[model samples]
Target: MKIATFNVNGINGRLPRLLEWLAEAKPDAVCLQELKAPGDRFPEAAIRDAGYGAIWQGQARWNGVAILARGADPVETRRGLPGDPEDAQARYIEAAVGGVLIGGLYLPNGNPRPGPKFDYKLAWTERLLAHAAGLIEAGVPAVLAGDFNIIPTDQDVYKPERWRDDALFAPEAKAAFQRLLDQGWTDAIRALHPDAIIYTFWDYWRNAFGRDAGLRIDHLLLSPSVAGRLAKAGVDRAVRGRDKASDHAPAWLTLRKA
Candidate 1:
């Protein structure tokens, strides 16, 4: 099975590009983030026409997440992450497809550090850690994939000194990411090509993409049961250079058949 994650930026505005990538990549399962649309407004017809079934949790003009399964609909598991009743954002979605539990996430960007947004980001990470531990203990084949909004190490960023104070590069966020890894989730891309500078996101300004100034924020993490099946992993960097493309390219992994 092949699994991929992409942050489309805005689904409606980028539907054409998204469909094009889907048709070309043909991943068996896809985790999508940042739909930037309300639930009722999701373009079901467009997605269906592309030969995929999807379940989305959307919020108007902001965060959203979805899971797409080629040739069939993903069975819904949960719409939002637990542990926070007051928190409401379409940033997390989980589903079951082809015997694998997939968790699609759009972690908070948390810009302008030393503020409330940054605090929320850390708290959310805590909740995610707790829930991820349960998934690990459950002993199911699972994947946690999406825009993590984290630069795991200085090596993952093009210019470490430039982004040292940014939320994505903050020590708190990186430490939280470590907590997840300590629970034993395999960072598939890093594991596959250790020491290589692979990036999935590039900003639109300053010719970041043109200059290859990018960050490796999007990720596909595998549980113990699924990590051993990993065969290949990569980033579709060409997609980020396409017309009307999202800032993020798709990060994908191939698994040996059970």
Candidate 2:
């Protein structure tokens, strides 16, 4: 099975680009972030025509998440992250597709740090850690895949020093990512290309994509059982340079079918 994740930026505005990619890449499953549309406005007809069934947690003009399964309907699992009843952002969604539990998330950006937004980001990650632990204990075949909005490590970005002050690369954020790895989730792209300088996102300004200045934020982290089947993984970097493209390229992994 080929599983992929993409931060579409704006689903309604970018539907054409997304549809084109879906036709060409043909991933068996995909997790999408940044829908930037309300629940009632999701382009269900277009996606259905593209031959994928999807379930989404939609919000207006900010954050949203969705899971799409090629040729089948995704069985809805969960709508939001646990441990936060008051939190109402549409940033997390989960579904069962082809017998695998897939968690799709769009973690908070938390820019202009040292404030409430940054605090929320940290707290959100804590919640994620707790839930991820449960998933690990259950030992199900699963994947946590999405735009994590985290740089993870110096090796995961180009010119790390330039982003040191950024929230995505902040020590606290990186530590949270480490805690997830400590729980035994395998970072699929890193596992496949341990020493490569792989990246999934590039800023639109300053010719970042042209100069190969990018960051590896979007990711597919696998539970142990699912990790064992990992065969190949990579970023579709070319997609980022296309006309009317999103800043993020699709990060994908292929696993052996049982």
Candidate 3:
């Protein structure tokens, strides 16, 4: 099965580009982040028309996530990450599609470090790691995919010096990201193309996309049960260059059939 993840930026604004990519890429399941729309406003009919059904957790003009399955309905697994009772951002949603457990996430940006937002980001990462451990212990083939808002390593970002102070590249943030991998999850893209400088997000400022100045924040991390199935992984870099495209591109993985 093929699984894909994308931070569409805004579903309404990027519908055309998103539909085109969906048709061309044809992934079996897609995990979407940053829908930036409220539940009532989700464009369900439009998504269904494109031959997919989805479950979405939305908040207008801000964090939101969804899971779309082609040719089948996704069985909702969880709505938000456990262990944070007061947490309310629509940043996480999970589902079971075609026997694969998939999670869509839009981790906090946590800009301007040494602040409350940065603290929240670290706490959120901890919760995710705990949840991930639980999933793996259950013996399910899981794929946690989306915009983690983290630059895992120097290789994952261009011009690492420029991003040193940013939350995405902060030492604490990178350490939290590493802890996830240490917990027995495999970074699919790195496993597939370790030496390739793959990037999933390019900022609109400074003509980043045109200059190919980007960061590999979006990712697909697989649990041990599914790690062996990794066949191919890539960033649809061309999609980011398209007209009215999102700052982020689609990142995907192909797994061997069970």
TM-score of each: 0.99, 0.99, 0.99
Query: How well does candidate 2 score on lDDT at residue 60?
Result: 94
Q: Of the candidates shown, which would achieve the greatest lDDT relative to the real structure?
A: 1
Error (Å) of candidate 3 at residue 180 is 1.0
Arranged by lDDT, best first: 1, 2, 3
Better of 1 and 3 by TM-score: 1
For all candidates, what are the clash counts?
A: 0, 0, 0
What is residue 170's positional error in candidate 2, in angstroms? 0.8
Taking the tens digit of each residue's C-alpha lDDT, what string does model 1 give over 58-121?
Answer: 9999999999999999999988889998889898999999999999999999988989999989
Candidate 3 per-residue lDDT over residues 153-189, each given as its tens digit? 9999989999999999999889988988988999999
Candidate 2 regions off by >4 Å?
A: none
User: Would you list the C-alpha lDDT of every candidate in the order shown?
Assistant: 0.95, 0.94, 0.93
Candidate 3 residue 253 Cα shift, in angstroms, is 0.1
- Which parts of model 3 are misplaced by more than 4 Å? none
Question: Model 2 Cα displacement at 11 (Å)?
Answer: 0.5
Q: What overall lDDT, based on C-alpha atoms, would model 3 receive against the true structure? A: 0.93
